[model samples]
Target chain A: MTTRTVTCEPQNFRRVLSSMCTEPHPLARQAASRFLATNPGDPTTYRTVSKLESEVVERLGEVTGQSDVEGYIASGGTEANIQAVRAARDFHDVNDPNVVVPEHAHFSFHKAADVLDVELRTVPLTERLVADVDAVAAATDRDTVLVAGVAGSTEYGRVDPIPKLADLAAAVDAFTHVDAAWGGFYLPFTEYDWNFADAAVDTLTIDPHKLGQAAVPAGGFLTQSRKIMDTLAVETPYLESTSQATLTGTRSGAGVASAVAVLRELWPDGYREQFETSMSDAEWLADALSNRGFDVVEPTLPLVAASVSERLFERLRKRGWRLSRTANGELRIVCMPHVTRELLESFVETIDELR
Target chain B: MTTRTVTCEPQNFRRVLSSMCTEPHPLARQAASRFLATNPGDPTTYRTVSKLESEVVERLGEVTGQSDVEGYIASGGTEANIQAVRAARDFHDVNDPNVVVPEHAHFSFHKAADVLDVELRTVPLTERLVADVDAVAAATDRDTVLVAGVAGSTEYGRVDPIPKLADLAAAVDAFTHVDAAWGGFYLPFTEYDWNFADAAVDTLTIDPHKLGQAAVPAGGFLTQSRKIMDTLAVETPYLESTSQATLTGTRSGAGVASAVAVLRELWPDGYREQFETSMSDAEWLADALSNRGFDVVEPTLPLVAASVSERLFERLRKRGWRLSRTANGELRIVCMPHVTRELLESFVETIDELR
Candidate 1:
């Protein structure tokens, strides 16, 4: 108590509908605290955390409909996505390698393209905001080494036709990467052909921190085969490990521990309940906005994009509501596990009051 | 009151003489938990933690002998080092960009080179284990984008001739980076010309998680000029922030919060006491090893590398001592903040008994 006060006050989860992350499950928060000082990067020293990371990867594969997969617990989806593109770029040794992705793919792909010196071809989406199959097919050339599909678009949460996208990449002998960061936990209960069992995905990005009820920075990256994962390995000169594949060294074990904690507590069944609740709340909010004469995108996933007036949006923001705007200037509200139906009802009341 | 038990037990700091990181301060551990669920990547939402990150960057600048520097809290030293190299490579705009570094620079430089598609030129070190000024100067050419000098090397705790290294980089019109990941906290108390005030160092990698007693994954990167830091920015499509300069998105505020916690608690006086204790223990270790007829490198910092027999090294491993070997097949003993002199005395007794 005598120590200096932390001026960085944590934001309330109840007020945050903008971010993809939700409040961590109680077990996850406890687990993260216990492993705050461990580093999984040195597997030999932090052997137990390293093993937990292995289990987390296996669980990610199991939920994504693939078993015995190989990967690491990435810092988050961005690092995982970058590694996927990096793996593809290294595997296919083409001059000026190009990567094709849906326009709705996360911005991490752009960071990957710029960092790795690869050409990024962003294909236009269909009317439903899913990846347009024809546009992706037209964009791919012989130099295209990686094709990415978004299972849950950030702005609209549209699930792209990942099966078709994978087939197109197969035609060019390129790697297929699916960015299911926000939808990895939710898509399992839905009948979407977006994961390994439904599509020939080479690599996938799934963040346990986002929708999996884990603490912050718990992202999962998995490969269907070990050979696909080995393309990103850089030989380690130190440590008991022979090679290192992670983007960052001295990686904290908190993410790994917390991810396993939540997965163990609420994998298929618990997540299913959360998904249903989130979807129902999203639908309710969309209907509530539409009834007020605001144009709204269909709630394909638990994310709604509504066309609110700029002044009203500013006023809502001024009301201390944590909100975000989409690329097309629509109000983006992600109904994460914490964004309950009751919370949305009150949010609508506040909007009505301001209007 | 029951849940699935965590299998990953935290490693004891007393036995961990190999890693640069030590136990997190009690205050830092508490602070890390408070901010575990907050995301600093979207600064507008996690305003307080983002503000703490600003304070951390400023504190890092102050400790590194520069005021009003610009940078961010990286995941760890690896990410910070990678970004430093990436910023330089992006800024130079040279075709076939190359990076010049001393032979004993951390393995992160190699990872950065591989990921960023840059040529790595490793110049051999001098007999003293520091970067050979002539060798580094000879390696640098017009195509060299970055020149790196290790302020505290991993193996022998060598402080490279950073001022000379900076001069060589200036001659080649390249950016200079000082890797002070291990030495940053200690060097401030010692007389070393290895920081912003001592040379024309454009970028520096220092970690609060290492010697600063913050939790794991709290590495700091500071740039002498805003221009160098600006080179790494990518435009953000969402959020109130205009651009994202960090390597990873969806960053956790735990590292930022804990870094400030430790920095506030032990900036100069607290760390000065620890540095003295660590150095005394290190010198004690070197003398203890030498007295037992083992060859030892001089402890330039709180790290001692001794050549023990392969059988003894394996025997020590079997006895549950957390140790590491260098590239030269020597036993490395790093006197981190927790590696007390009494612990080293017991280690010596164990070695004598094993013999």
Candidate 2:
């Protein structure tokens, strides 16, 4: 009898292993090595998990100018959104709570609503592809527990008018949650003063894995009010002696340690420098794409979304440039710390030639 | 100006580091290294995560002589129970769904109910501290969606009469979930011929971190029916992407890698030998405790719970022995892979001297 053997592709193997140690910098590697050498207990304890969580939150508070901040480490942006929705719903005591979101909001909001059985009210976008605050205000009702404002919406990478959304939410006594998963790390360092705390947003979800180059599963839920976090606490003696304030117990301390290492290494100037360079690269990519006759959306943010006139995307793919598509038929090229200006310029040149 | 410098105690520093890496075994170290090297995406996915969830179900199928078995990876035992409760509630569609559990059942079941807002009925235990099947049968009602049987109750580490409980669940058409979190990795290799799938269990929760010596955050939920697992799925555009099928998204591929490495390193014979040795150590500990006149609870499986006569506990603590207490004044000591017969014997000798 003959047996078949299964094997994984070499590139895929490389990508997977690289994801384990996502940090490009050497300090992150040292911190991870040291952490693995030491802390090996279950990371569910407040003493261990909370200390790391508070460290991240404290740094975020300093960056955003928010002092009374309470945050919890989560698996990713999705879990953070789910927990935020749960807290908002339980706080408002809405049996069939509703969330008002822009059409371009991240899919996490829709996923949160689906899991919690909360009604989702999708508002139309403005001409600039930003959330139409008026549409959101018009959609709000007494049953609305949360009004979501997108900070760097996935489609166009344009931040919603958070101040206007906060005002609307305040008028209706609804909670304002900013989906800052993509923009939280950038906005604070970028010239844009779009911090959720300053805009009076109640809750925000941020992913360190996306911008900080930490390993996967490093995300957080930031809220100005501690009361909101209290509502999500579930007591269990099996995993936790006290109440587990997060969605999952027995979390990986390695991820937390990695985040701490990344934050420590990139204190004040490091983050600012990286953010500036990425933003500049985004602008350069946007200009190149536009000069090549592509309609680029929200050319200001670190994400450049463009619509190809011909088979430019196919040609770019052949040249080894990977990109994701938005619901609005726009291709999004996100400029991370790893993507250099030269690389973006070369890719844009290839696109122009293909067009 | 003199600045006050903060200093950490050597023990405290060691404890802080130890919290991240709880197990002090060489195998755990080797596994962690291999885990760190594995990636969570594609080709590395198999090594990153113990997609052995399906393998476990397959093993269960073979053990029970049942063909239909399904399983999913979970963060830990608590998450597994939470999902099981959610699935039961949604599948049964019972208004104010209730779960019947023994008084000594792991607290995760109660926590799951509290989080889901489902009614929980705790049946009283027998004099031996095992689940009284008749009490569980009497506690059932039309509102009950699940009857939970603990394979190893945390207090006394006694396996409930699962066969009898399954018979009772069948009588009422209630779904039976076995919380074998501590015992799942042990019973398969031990003398316990009871197959979880054959014992009328619709679902079983297992923790590889506890007994299998994998990294923390490694657990699983095994089910005999794919239909049950389907009920926990939250279908939304954002979360229902090609990869995720659980409550969490973007999990640590490192933890998954650790689980796979631990499981692979300890296959059929490895598991059997380790568990058999642990059982023997447990038996030796029980005998030593009994000889010292401590009211040692008889071994339910491999666990030995004892009442240390309050005065004896204080004396043991004074002698530098760390032990956990139960609700009913019982001291519990788990014999993990890191714990050896020598350590158990030393503790027993100390107890004898103190007594």
lDDT of 2 by residue, B1-355 (tens): 1111111112322212112123523444444543442323222233314453444445435433356767655666777887787778778866678889999877667657655668889999999788888899899988888888887676666778888888887777788888877777677754543455458788888776566566655667778787876776554331113434466655544455455555655655777787789789989888887887778888856667787788986687666554556776677777766567877777777766877
Per-candidate clash tally: 0, 13
For model 2, residues A311-351, the per-residue Cα lDDT tens digits are: 76556655555444565546777676766777676776676
**Tens digits of lDDT, candidate 1, B51-157:** 99999999988899888899998888999999999999999968889999999999999999989999999999889899999988889999999999999899988
Q: Tens-digit lDDT track for model 1 on A129-199?
A: 99999999999989999999999889999999999999999999999999999999999988899999998
Which segments of model 1 are wrong by more than 4 Å? A1-3, A7-11, B1-3, B7-11
Angstrom error of the Cα, residue B324, model 2: value is 2.9
Off by over 4 Å in 2: A1-25, A33-50, A191-196, A238-241, A308-323, A342-355, B1-69, B170-173, B191-196, B235-243, B309-323, B346-355
- Candidate 2: residue B4 lDDT (0-100): 16
User: RMSD, model 2, all Cα superposed?
Assistant: 5.1
